[model samples]
Target: MTMYSVDVYSGSSDSIIQDSHAQAVIVKATQGTGYVNPKCNHQVELAKSLGKKLGYYHYAGGGDPVAEADYFIDNINGYIGTGMLIIDWEGYQNSAFGNTTWVRRFVDRVHDRTGVWCVIYVSESALAQVANCANDCGVWVAKYASMTWGSWTVPNMAVSSGAFKFITGWQYTGGDMDRSIWYLDEAAWDKFAKANVANPTPSPQPKVDQAKPVVNPQTTWTDNLGDTWHAEDGKFISNTALHLRWGARPSASTIAVLPAGSVIKYDAWSRGNEFVYVRQPRGNGYGYVAVRNAHTGEAYGRFE
Candidate 1:
């Protein structure tokens, strides 16, 4: 079924739900590295009160996409009305090196954190910015065929862009604000209402053991726990609470919980290729953490 929503920035101070007939709203939740949309929480809360589905997007400025994705998720992850996580990828230069890589990093990280795969919002210029971006993510495109409030044809134009399997949204109107139609039917839209990891309390992540002593994969390394380590990179924990385990797997015993910004020294990769062996970055015992903490681009993670 066709759904409508508007993407707003800090300038949108009006009551979005009260002012429009849209079924959902995609508020700009964050920008660049540290800034957040002041009105986003209000919009989300208001949308929730009105029983409207809600969504959010992050303005992916030319920075680390992984960090930006985490920032975006941090701002709006647990909303009961959340329908989608969109990465606004329209203005980060013309398919620059590491652009697709960073976007994918962001997408995968958001999925890992929220259990929902995020969608990408792009203009025609950035439609093909990242190859395989839509393989795992839905694509929301912005190709305005008309600017008037009645311009429903723009959604058709957006579909012609070939940016997605189906265009999630088509920005038909632009000016002081932007508006679009989510191209899903009511049944499909309902599925999207909580489609992206809607579990209010995510089920406990089972631990996957990775304690194998790998003699060689890319480079040879010893399995000794206290072996001398080499420098691949430096990183610190960025999540609010991170689990420390007795082994290099998700199922390892939770030895401790390290708070956000804990400094960690990544020791090596586990045999399973999913967990990371880290030194006592938080003075916690050395065990393992998932290798997908891209908020700060942790080493042995999705991002370099």
Candidate 2:
């Protein structure tokens, strides 16, 4: 069954729920790495009181995708695993507007942190820019029949997403408050709000002593600073003299100091920490370096 939802920003008042026929309420929570919607909390609370399905979105500011993801997660920490997470990909003042990988990286970071894949919101005309994300993230294609502000109506228009087999949501109307048609029922909406994990054992199975030996378990290594590192590949360039460390944290051991304008290749990166550090391949083990300020998107070095 199709359900209705409304998305509101700071300009909107709490009366949105009082005026709309929406069964769900998705509010703008954050933008870039800096701005949080001032009235977000109140709007969310009103929805909660009415027992409406909830959603929160981050408006991409065309900055460091990972940093922006972290910022969005940080502000909406309490609401994680409780509402549908969305990334609003728009071109207004966004520097990364045309980059295909921006939404991919942002949604990847969100899933890595919270175990919940986010839905990508983009206009129908800009579908190509976020095509890379179609495989993992759901698409919420926005295409209005006209620019007129009108009441809720079932959308008859078509949304063509090439790689994405189907859209999870469609924003069909635009005005003081935009309306969307969610292609899911209440139960399905709850499932999207839960954490998604791989190979979950539903119930404990009896151990067999005669079973064949398990092969190739996943391996993770902890650094001297007690930070865990995982294998990842990327190229990095230092804009200034930066410390190559022994771990992912800021307090990790500084292995070497790269001169300004240095370029290095990394084989791995670390997560679940305050800052994200890339690991450079050394003689036997690896060396770590801070790629950017995880919260502020201030890069010590640029990623290639």
Candidate 3:
């Protein structure tokens, strides 16, 4: 269904109402040199409140790509792994640095740190500068306020059917403003959202008893990262108080807020070392939480 979505920036309206027809929104949440979009959180929460899938972008400013990527990632960490962390590349302020290499560095850093795939956003003139990288990452080419056949000089066709080959986003225009259409249909769009955005802000978790087992009738519970739950019940002493989530996914709902030094009975589901599944303290429910990395036999969870 070629879904409709928008890309906004600091100049865009602070208050936004969810557009049911729009499947998602890509907001400019950060920019070069540690500058952040003031309304990033509000825009994200508003879009999420309206049930719209959300993504974020950073306006590159010809700086240290790695450092800039780190800055952007830090700002969007809450929304990290939720959707695309776009590298908005037009050109560089620093004549000394090459745009393509820096863009790749930034994108790689983002992916390495967040585990969510990054995308590229470039103007028509700037597309060629990063086209080499675009084939690896989905490219959001921005020629203008709208995308129409032959509207821009750059060809909007397939470089290849690779990871981000298809111009997944073509910025078509409306009301003299910027908007984009996901090239794939509804199912693919949804699938893309889930695959790219593994985490978002969680909802409130339901109460559960600490000693009860965390399980469901079925045994096929896993996440995009391939971490399985309902494996085994294990006891963990909290190295620090953590926020409990409804599920193992980072975007799960927060069910319990535990303070440091609290001992928790949890299922020892293994997914690297940052995420842990614990039975709730009050009900027979399972909630996810992140803890400090366990040392030797100490309990730990992944944060980065």
Measured by TM-score, the strongest candidate is 2
lDDT, candidate 1, 94-213, per-residue tens: 133336577788878887776677767775445666556666676666654322224333332213446455555666555334667765655555444454533222122223235643
Q: Per-residue alpha-carbon lDDT of model 3 for 65-163, expressed as tens digits?
A: 888888887877777646666777753333423455777888778877866657676644455567657545766655322111212122332222233
lDDT of 2: 0.75
Candidate 1 positional error at 29, Å = 1.1
Tens digit of lDDT per residue, candidate 2, span 1-304? Answer: 6778988888776777755488999989999999999999999999988989999999999999999999999999999978889999876557787899999999999999999888889877688998887777777887654323255864444457657767788887654457888778787787667788321111121232345542211235776665555444568788898888766666868888899888889876554224557778899687877775533334666666
List per-prediction Cα lDDT, in the order shown.
0.57, 0.75, 0.56
| 10 residues in a row with least lDDT, candidate 1 | 199-208
- Looking at candidate 2, the ten consecutive residues that score lowest on lDDT are 198-207
Residue 226, candidate 2: Cα error in Å is 52
Q: How many residue-pair clashes does candidate 1 contain?
A: 6
Index of the highest-lDDT prediction: 2
**Candidate 3 Cα lDDT to native:** 0.56
At residue 43, candidate 2 shows an lDDT of 92
Q: Give residue 212's lDDT in candidate 3 (0 to 100).
A: 60
- Which sections of candidate 3 miss by over 4 Å? 14-21, 92-98, 145-164, 185-304
